[model samples]
Target: MAVYTKRDFSVNLKSHGGILILALIAVFHLWIQVTGLQYTTAAKTGWIIGMTPVFMALLGLAVFKESLTLIKTSGILVAFFGLILLISHGDLSSIDLISNKGDFLILGSSFTWAVYSIVNKKISLNYPPMMTILFLFLMMGIIISPFTINDASIQSVIHLTFKGWIAILFLGILCSGAAYVMWAQALKEMESTKVGAFLYFEPFVTVIAARIVLNERITLLMILAGIIITLGVVLVNVNLKKIVLYKKSKKDM
Candidate 1:
C-alpha cells in the first residue's frame, strides 16, 4: 500500500499499524489454506473476499459519515469487473467457480478486515496508530493460539511440507503483520479510497508472484488483461486535468 500524509510525509505506516493488520490477515490465510485443501474452484472464495469492500464502504458511510463519491463508486465497479475478468476469464459454465469452502472463509476474512479498517479510522483519531495495532495483534495472537497445532499425530490430518510452513510463517509475519500496520498508518493520513485503490494492484501482484513461484506461463491474454487493468487503475486515480494535458502533449508531438 502507498502512503498518504497531509503533514508528515516521512511517517512510517509499517512501523505503526502493520502487525495487527497482519495478524488478521494471517488468520484469513490460515483459514483459506485449511479450507482450500478440501475444496475446489476459486469463484466462491473470490466472491466472499470480493464482497468486503462494498460492505466496508457501506459501513464507512453509515457509521463514519464518509461519503462515497460517484467517481470512487465507479472505480470500485470497474476494479471488480476487472477482477471478474481476470479470475473467470471467459468460462461461464465452470462449476469449479462455486465449489470451495474456502469461499466462506474468505468472506469471513473480509468481514474481519472491514472491522479492522473501520475501527482503525475511528481509533486512530484518539490513539497512537502503532499502539492500537500492537494491542489488536496481541488480542489476535491470543485468539488464534487455540487453532495452532498442538498434537503430533495431527500432522497426518493436515499434511504440510517445509515450504508450506515457511509460506505460512511469511504470510503471518510480512504480509499479515507488517503490511497491515503499514496500511493502517497510511489510512490514518490518506483518504480511504486512495488507500483502498492499492487493492487493485493485489491481483497483479498475485499473478506475478504465482508466475515466479509456480513457473506459470504468462500468455497474451494475461498481458492484455494486465493492460486493461492498468488502464482502469489510471482512470480511477488520474487527475482529469493531467489526462487532458497529456493528450494535448501527444497531439503536439
Candidate 2:
C-alpha cells in the first residue's frame, strides 16, 4: 500500500493516529475473542456476534450521523430477535447460562468490533482501504509480538509441520489480512449499517464449518433459526426506495 501511495516520505504513514488507535483496539478485540473461547462454546459466541450489526447501526447513527429508517430499524430488531432465539436454542432461559463470564467477554468483543468497524469506516473515507488495513496489521503485529513470543520460538517455526504452516498462513494471510481488507472496502462503499448486516451470516457459516469439520449435529431448530436470521438480514438490506414505493402503493387504497 505504501508503494502505491506515491507519498514522498514513508514516515507519513505514521501521521495517521487513527490507524495506531485502530491497532490497539484490534489487540484487545483479538485477545478477548481468543481467550474467551476457553470459557464458552463457539456456538454461543457466534450467536452473540450476530448482534454486531445492531451495534454498528447505533454507532453509525451516533458518531457518523448515519440515518435510520423505519424499515432498517425494524429489520435490525427482527434479525436480533432471531439471533437471540438461535443462540438460546428457542429457550430464553438459556441466556442465563451466560453468567459464566465468557459470554460477557464475547459481548465485549462485539462492542470492540463495532467500534473497530465504525472507526475503520470513518478512516477509510480519508485513507485508502489497503493503506489503512495494512498499516493496522503491521501495528497490531508489533503490539502482539511480545505477548506471543514466549509461546513461539525460532525452532517451532523452523520445525513446523506442513499442515501447521498451511493453517498459520491461511489465518494470517487470508482470514486476518484479506478478509479485513475486503470488509473495510465494503464499509467504504456502503453504509456501516448495511455493511454490518453481513455479520449475521457468521453464525451460519460457523455452524456449517463445525458440522463439516467437527461432525456437529445440525438440528431442525438450527435450520429454522438460520432461515429467520437470513430473512432479517435481507430485510435490513432492502432498499428504502422500494420500501417507500410499497408503502405508497398500499396508501393509494
Candidate 3:
C-alpha cells in the first residue's frame, strides 16, 4: 500500500524520529501484545489492553503537559471501571495481575502504547501515514526475524492450512496495515487522548465478535458494561462550552 501510494522516500532528522516512534509502536502494539496474550486469558488481555486510554491520559498530562479536563478524567475512570466489569463478569476477585506474567507483559504493552500514541501524535505529521505504517511493518519483521527465521518457524509456515493463511493475511492487511494508517491519520486530525478514547470500544467489539464467531454467551452485565463504555467515550469527546452555550440559548428561547 505504501509503495502504491507513491510518496517520496526522503530522509531527514525528523524522519529519523518518525522511524524511531514507528519502531516503538511496532514493538509494543504488535510484539508485546502478541507475547502477552500467550500468557493470559483473552478476556484478561482485553481488559488490560483496554487500559491504554487511561494510561494515555495520565501520561499525556505528565509528560506532554496536556490538559486533563473534568469530563475527560471522568470518562477515563468510567471506561476503566466498565472494562473491569466486562472482563470480571461481576466477579472482581478474579481481576488479579500480580501473579500473572502475561498480565504484567500486557500491562507494559498498554503503558508503552499510551506513550507511543502521545508521542506519535506529534511525530506522525511529518510523514505520509501509509509510508509510516509501511516502515512500521518493516521494523516489526526485522525485530521478529531473529526469532522466526528458524527451522521450526519455517516448518510451521509450510504446514499452515489455507484458512490459517487467510487469517494471517487478514491480520497483516487489515489489522496492522490499514489500522495503523487510520490511527496515524486520526492522531494527525484529533487529540491523542480523544483518539485513545476510541480504543475503549475494542473490548466491546471483541465481546460482540466472540458471540458471533466463537458462540460465546453474552450476559446482561456485559451488555450493560458496553453501554457504559459507549457513554464514557461520549463524555471524553463532548465539548463542554458548546453544551453550556446551547443550553443557555434554549433557555432564552
Candidate 4:
C-alpha cells in the first residue's frame, strides 16, 4: 500500500503476518458479539459484554504473565459485582430470571474479546498501532462481507434512505474504523488489565445513548447501577496496598 498509495513503511511481510493473526482474533471476537446478540436481549448482551475487562485481566495474567496484585484482583471482583448490579438492574432476582443460550454466547464473546485485547497488545509491541488496525479492518471487512452479500441485501442497499446511508458511513468510518484504531492505540500504551476497566462503563454509555436516541426513561435503578459500575471500575484501578494501609490507619484511630 505504501508503494502504490504513496505511503511510508518499514514493516516486513513477516511483521504483517503477525498483525494479520491478531486481526483474525479480533474478527472472531466481532463475529461472536454479532452472533450472540441474535439469541439474547440487548440488555443481557451488554451486561455479559461488560465482563470483558475481568476476563482480560485474567488472561493478561495467564497468557502474558502480567502482574496480578491483590489490589487488581479485588478490583476485578468489585468490577464484577458492579457488572452484576448493572445487568440485574439492582434486583438480585432478575439475574436468575434471565439465563439462556444467548447469555452463554455473550460470555464466550467476552472471553474472546479479552483474548483479542491481550494478543493485540502483545503484537503492538512490534508493529505500528494505526497500520495494524488498518490491516485488521481491511481483513475483517473482507471476511465479513460474504455473510452480508446476498441478493436481498444488494437490493436493500440501493433502497437505503439518505439518513440510513449517512448512519452507515458514520459507523463504518467513525465507529468501526476510527474507534478501532484509537482502541488499538490505547492497548499499545496500557496494560491490558488496566485497559479492561473501560469495558465496565459500556453499559452506562449504552443507557445514556438509549435515553437520547430511543427516548428510554432513566430510572433510579439505572442511576444506582451506573454508580456501582463506576465504583467497581475505580476499585479495579485503585492501589490495593494504599487502600489497606489507609483502612488500617483509620482503624488505629
Candidate 5:
C-alpha cells in the first residue's frame, strides 16, 4: 500500500501512539478469537461473534458518547434475534455459553473488536487509510513475532501443503489486509454502530459460502433468518429523515 501510494511513511508521535494502541488491540482480538474457536462449536462461535454490533453500540454510547437512537436500538435487537434464530436453528435451548470456557474468550474478542472499531474511528483519520493499516500490521507483526517465530511454528509452516499456503495467503492478504483497510475507511465515514451492524452478515455469508463450496444444504429456516438479518442491517443504516423528505417531495411533484 505504501509503495503504491508513493507517500512517505512518516507520522507524528501522537499518530504513532494511536497505531501502537490499535495494533495491541488487534493482536489481542485475533488471539482471543483463535483460542476461543478451539473450545467452542462453530455455531456457538458465530452466534457470539455476532454480538459485536451490540458491543459496538454499547461501547459507542459509553465511551464515545455516540447517540443510541430508537431506530438503532430496534435494529440491533432485530438483528440479534435473527442471529439467535440462525445459530440455534430454532432451538434456543441449545445455545448455551455458560458451560463453555471458549465462549467467554470469544465474547472478549467481540468486545475487543468493538473497542478497535471505536478507537480506529478516532485515530484513522490521522493518516491515509492504507498507511494506517500498514503501520498497524507492521506493529502487530513485531509484537507477535516472538511468539510465532519458534522452531515448531517454522516447521509447521514448512510442512504446510499448497492448499494450506493458499489459505494462509487468502486470509492474510484479503481477509486481514484488504478487508481491514476497507473497514477503516468505512469507520472514517460512518457511525460505528452502523458499520458494526453489517457484521451481522458474517454468518449469513458463511452459510452461503458453505452451501456453494462445501455443498451444504440450506434449510428454509436459514433463508428466513438471512432475510431478517438483512432487514435489520438496512434498518440500522437507513436515514428516516431522508426517506420522509423524499416521500414528501414526490407527493408535491
Candidate 6:
C-alpha cells in the first residue's frame, strides 16, 4: 500500500501483457452502462456472476490443494447468501435473451477485474506499485477512448452546461482516472482476494452517488442490502487465522 506514495519509476516497469489486460477491463467498464440500461437497474444477476470468484477459489483449493479454512469457507458462503438477498426480488426470466446479454457484460467485467488483479500482483513484483497502476490506467484510458466519444452519450460534452462539465470532470478525472490508479496500487501490494473485497463497497458507492446526483430515493431495501453487502465484504476480507487466534486467546483467558 505504501507503493501509492513511493516515487520509484525505475522499480515499476510496465508489461505489454499487463497493459492489454488492463485495457480490456477499461473497455468492459465503459460498456457496463449498456447492462444497466438494459436491465433497467443493476440487479442480482451481476452480483451472482461476480460471486463466482469465490467458487473458483474454492475449486482451486479442492483440486490444487489451496488452503481452505473454516472461516474462509464461511465467509464465502455468507457473501453468496448476501448477494442472493441483494437481488432476490428481480426476475431475470421475463427477458431471458437480453438478460443473458446483461449478465454476459457484467460477468465479462468481473473476469477482466480478476485478470487485472492477477496481473497487478505480477507487475508489482518488479515495479513500484503506483507506477504499475498509473501505466495501467493510461493504457485503459487509451483503450476506452473510442467508447467515450462525444456523440449521443456525450451530449453534455457537446452542449456543456456548467454542471454538465463539472460532472464530466468529476467522472473523468477524479472517479475514473484517479480511482483506477488507487485500485491498481491496492492490487499491487495486496492479494487479489484481499483487494477484490472492495467490490462489495461498489454498490454502496453507486447508490449514494446516484442518490446525490440523480436525486434517487434511498429506499429501505437499498439500505438493508448495502449493510448486508458490507457484512459480506467484511467476511470475505477478514483474517481467518487472526480471528481463530483471538478466539483461542479468549478461551485460554
User: Among these predicted structures, which one has the highest lDDT?
Assistant: 5
For candidate 2, write residues 1-253 as lDDT tens digits. 4466663434345437988989998999989988788886676666667667777777888998877778768877887777677667788876765555676788789889999999998788878787788778889989888877774576788889999999999998788888988998998999887788788689878877877776767778766766675676666666778779999999997
Cα lDDT of model 1 by residue, 1-253, tens digit:
1233223334345544554564565567556645763552332333334444554665677777867667646755765565445444445353244643344445456566666677676666655566655666676777687777578647744798888889888987797668867876887897554565565555456556656765556666555554554455544554566679999999999
Window of ten residues with lowest summed lDDT in model 1: 1-10
C-alpha lDDT of all candidate models, in order: 0.58, 0.78, 0.74, 0.72, 0.80, 0.59
TM-score of each: 0.61, 0.79, 0.82, 0.77, 0.82, 0.68
Please list the residue runs of candidate 2 whose C-alpha ends up more than 4 Å from where it truly belongs after superposition: 1-15, 40-44, 97-102, 151-159, 242-253
Could you give candidate 5's per-residue lDDT for residues 183-229 as a string of tens digits?
99999988887798678677666666666776667678866776675
Give stretches of model 4 more than 4 Å off.
1-6, 9-11, 35-48, 88-105, 198-201, 240-253
Superior candidate under TM-score, 4 versus 5:
5
lDDT of 4 by residue, 1-253 (tens): 3234554566557667777777678778777777778776565455567667777767877988867777667777776776666556667687652455566667788888788788788778777777777677777777778888999999999999999999999988787777877788899888776677777678767766767776666667656655655565566566567679999999999
The candidate, 4 or 6, that scores higher on lDDT is 4
Error of 1 at 183 (Å): 1.8
Lowest lDDT block of 10, candidate 4: 1-10
What value of lDDT does candidate 4 attain over all alpha carbons? Answer: 0.72
Residues 164-237, model 3: lDDT tens digits:
99999999888877887899889889887778878867876776676677666667886777667556656665
Which residue runs of candidate 5 sit more than 4 Å off their true CA positions?
39-48, 83-104, 214-234
Q: Backbone clashes per model, in order?
A: 8, 0, 0, 1, 0, 3
Clashes of 6: 3
Which residue pairs collide, candidate 4? 75-236
